[model samples]
Target: MKKSKWSAYLAVIMASAISCFWAFWGSMENFHEGWHYPTLKENLTVMAIQYLSFMLIFILFSVIAILLPKIGSILYFLIGVAFSYWIFSTRSAITLSVVLSWLPLTLPLLLIALLFWFGEFKNRKLALFIAIGFPLLICCTISIKMGVRVSRRFHDGNYEERIVKGNNDVTLVWASQGPGWPKESIDWAEAQRRCIYLKENGKELADTPQNIWRLPNIKEVTSSLTRNGQNCQGVWNPEAREANYSFPPDKESPLWDIYSPIIYFWTSEEKDKDNAYIVVYHGGVFSKPKKMRGSVGFRAVKSVKNR
Candidate 1:
């Protein structure tokens, strides 16, 4: 093969690899979150659309470049410029780190555009194959991996309230659906208020604020982390700001809805008046602004009755 053909192949590989990475990431995210939808058909449909949307643009560009090089070159350049503008507009300061962070995405795009414009490849078939085949292979590999992981996950199909006993003589009845385990992200204050207003059964809210349920403390969350229906023996150290576990916990049943996108749960521990601590599924704790609510939720718990 000539040098120009090799360069064209490299450009095709780069574009396909970049698109495949985004496709894989989007697929995993959709798999994690899309299962919560009502029906199986809905879940599959939504997941396919969500992940495929990420790759469609790149696939179109590749096809157009193979058919009409000049048009594809213009499209790729426009996309690169759009990405650069978005990145710079979103950041308050145009630091080297910012530029460097975006270079991986924008630079390849610009370079690939130039390559498509000037490079000559007699074997258009090979160029098309590299463009489409590589992404297909990546998507298939990721699908198989995600399928295995999902199949192995522990799910009892039970979402009822349960009493969990943990280290430090901590025992609490975790709330079921509703305020205890909400699907939507919530601010710290709203989480607290919802927990306070949660009724005894944990399925509904009361007219007046009730004390039946409240946000679990960081230690309580850590200590109660479980895997395969067994305690993980998690311990939280406030001084060190760390959590240790005999067996690392996961986003599993009883405590967490594995299909839900909410991975971090708000705890009662406040870093300061402005920030509050949240616990992750794997027994990691971090502080966030009290008002930040993207992927963080709350699970209400009440002290177990003396027995």
Candidate 2:
């Protein structure tokens, strides 16, 4: 009711909200990467633990802060200092932008610590409820919304092959699950080499280098982008190095494994000797270093043999 009490409640709310946002973000990322599809091979329990670690840690901090303000103040202060040090040390050059970015993450912790130390709250029970319940409610609401969306995703379980007819009559058969369609992230060169070595069946690799299958060019990949089993009508502009699509493609069946973390596919189009073009699930095109890996993969394609 008093001004000081209102400030204390606000501090608790702010801290809880920030922690909850990050926890929810992390959880959503994990869900998309690990739990969206039933065929995902990752252990559900392990993924839950790994993704929800942030939420658990923050919840613990919230409990301690609500019950013991003095100790909580010290804990938050130390965390703020450590975070500040980390921000400064990791950057090679300190600029206004860097300082501005640092403030949002570090300043709140420091302020909350000060507020908790000085402010008085007679209703600790209500404070505890606000601190814990608010975040839990937020996380649950958004997660349910996302879960519904993910459940509605379409997967015909036909990863073996798909006939994608592109502009200029560029028709090709996308490879099935094997060397032609790798599940893990791979560098551009390795992807190219793998494609070159892929067998005609598109599911096996040969000992000697072969050209049965190869990486799809940027134009072919862009035009083949699809959404809900429908082509997205994607067009690539090499001069501008950009792509336009009638509808945004999603991580779904046929072209992509919804559960896989690989979002970008390496294209045979090269920007230069050092960099090559890659296409995203949404049909966006960008150039990345040939040697770079992580979240990047390749799906070998070949000319339709019978056609």
Candidate 3:
């Protein structure tokens, strides 16, 4: 068709190729680090399948934007930016959810999209400003709204089972309302290991949920369980109002009790196959799984506010 259109399509192809190459390099290295050795050819084949599948969506989307000019390139840009940013930031597997994280990446690209779609720099300054400003406004506003929602929910007794803390190491409160650790029997061994890890890493576990601790060889996690009804079919703990009650929907929640209050999460401590413990809230639970591949979900603990 148009020479300009051809140029844009080439650019899209080049960008996609570059990104694919980068992902390939990174994934290969990460696999080596994780496996403690290089990947076999079979593993490489599978990883190739996974990687190509993951990169294809963005590449195809970019192709479409190149092929069509009238259909709202802003949307296309959103797809590109959000997808690339999430891959760069979180480096999640090439799954649909990670693909969706590409929404944020749309901002800067919007300017390019406008340039390509309109072929005019007449209002470029204003358009570029809007492009940059839009995503920031959306992200910041969404974050603030979520914070407010969480605060309101907590005040409404939703998180009663969780402990909250300030960034300044406020004397920790066990999930005050629920049956949390006895405080006297706070498995000191696991706590020592975790402190050692943190000290060595020199990294602080901020307000993110991962900061929540599951003490090794500890049983405090059992105390965090609470059922909303007499049936004990795994309802939110009434005392859990203080906890960041991210419990899945009832239909999605599995039926079990004295459950670790969480399931199937990566623990800071792994003891071979059958036994290990994971964090629940800033190092709170410390439940010892009776079996490997247990499904005790997880949540993080972080400062109430980063400030």
Candidate 4:
């Protein structure tokens, strides 16, 4: 009976440790990369905050498991089940490989819970091996790959340009690029905030004025397009209008050339009570609400209003 009780305690400890490690590792890695331009002090502050937050959660989990072993094991099992659903729900297109990859992140917690609940049944060693081994392997492999990719982008000069001065009549300033894949993309409101930041900060050039720039209207956004080489079409909806870049890009539009990959931008035009027009540089165009979030970007336009 002593051995049995000890197994339950050990299982609980292992489960908490592995779960905390996975959570901390994933959160820190994404946090490090998302705000890529943070100074050393800012980065350290963020890390400290994240560490404290996760550590508190970890302590709570440990206490629960220590005080109520059976209930804690059940809770851990439920968490694992919920996480399985979460992994699939987050996928843009679910497939076998995606499901398989996500399993490593959650399976260990489930296995540890099972061990605690059943008191070390047959094949427990195999279960333990799987619980511990898979996450470590996957986490290390992913970390190395992420480090390499970030380093390559740093050296390749692929960082998005912050400000691009257009013709003297109007100036175009770049907005948020967002946190890349597997995260909520910059929405229309956030994009607008980026523009406001630039305008107030002189577009990082030390001389630009503030409050003159604003989110461009549908007409103004369309007017900036230069159909230099390819056919362009004006796509209109009841609430808004957009110019499609078609299959070939407009070599003339400087904005299009820079953000050629995913040049979707939000316009100030409103579509009904909620939706607004979004201009796409490559994948045609459509409208969505200001609250709707996606990978859309924006360019703040500034000019003297006609008298």
- The TM-score values for the models, in the order shown, are 0.85, 0.84, 0.27, 0.39
Backbone clash total, candidate 3: 37
Model 3: per-residue Cα lDDT over 160-191, one tens digit each: 33343222233222322122222122232434
Ranking by lDDT: 1, 2, 4, 3
| Tens digit of per-residue lDDT, candidate 1, span 1-307 | 3337566667677778877877777677765554555466877687778766777678778878877877887888898999889989999999999899888878988998888777677888988887788777777787778767665566677778878788778898988877667878999999988888888889998989888788889889999888887889998898999999998887777788876778889999898999999998768899999999777888889988721
lDDT of 1 at 25: 78
Candidate 4 off by > 4 Å: 1-33, 37-115, 119-129, 154-272, 276-289, 292-299, 302-307
Any residue pairs clashing in model 4, and if so which? 276-288
Q: Over the stretch 236-290, how does candidate 4's per-residue lDDT look in tens digits?
A: 3434333443333332344443322234668776667677778664434577777
- Model 4 RMSD to the real structure? 11.8
lDDT of 2: 0.79
Q: Write candidate 2's Cα lDDT for 188-297 as tens digits.
A: 99998988888778888899887878889988988887787777888888778888888787777778887667888999989899999998876778889999887899
- Candidate 1 has its poorest 10 consecutive residues by lDDT at 30-39
Alpha-carbon shift of residue 215 in model 3 (angstroms): 4.3
Which of candidates 2 and 3 is the stronger one according to lDDT? Answer: 2
Instruction: List the candidate 3 regions with Cα displacement exceeding 4 Å.
Output: 1-120, 153-277, 280-307
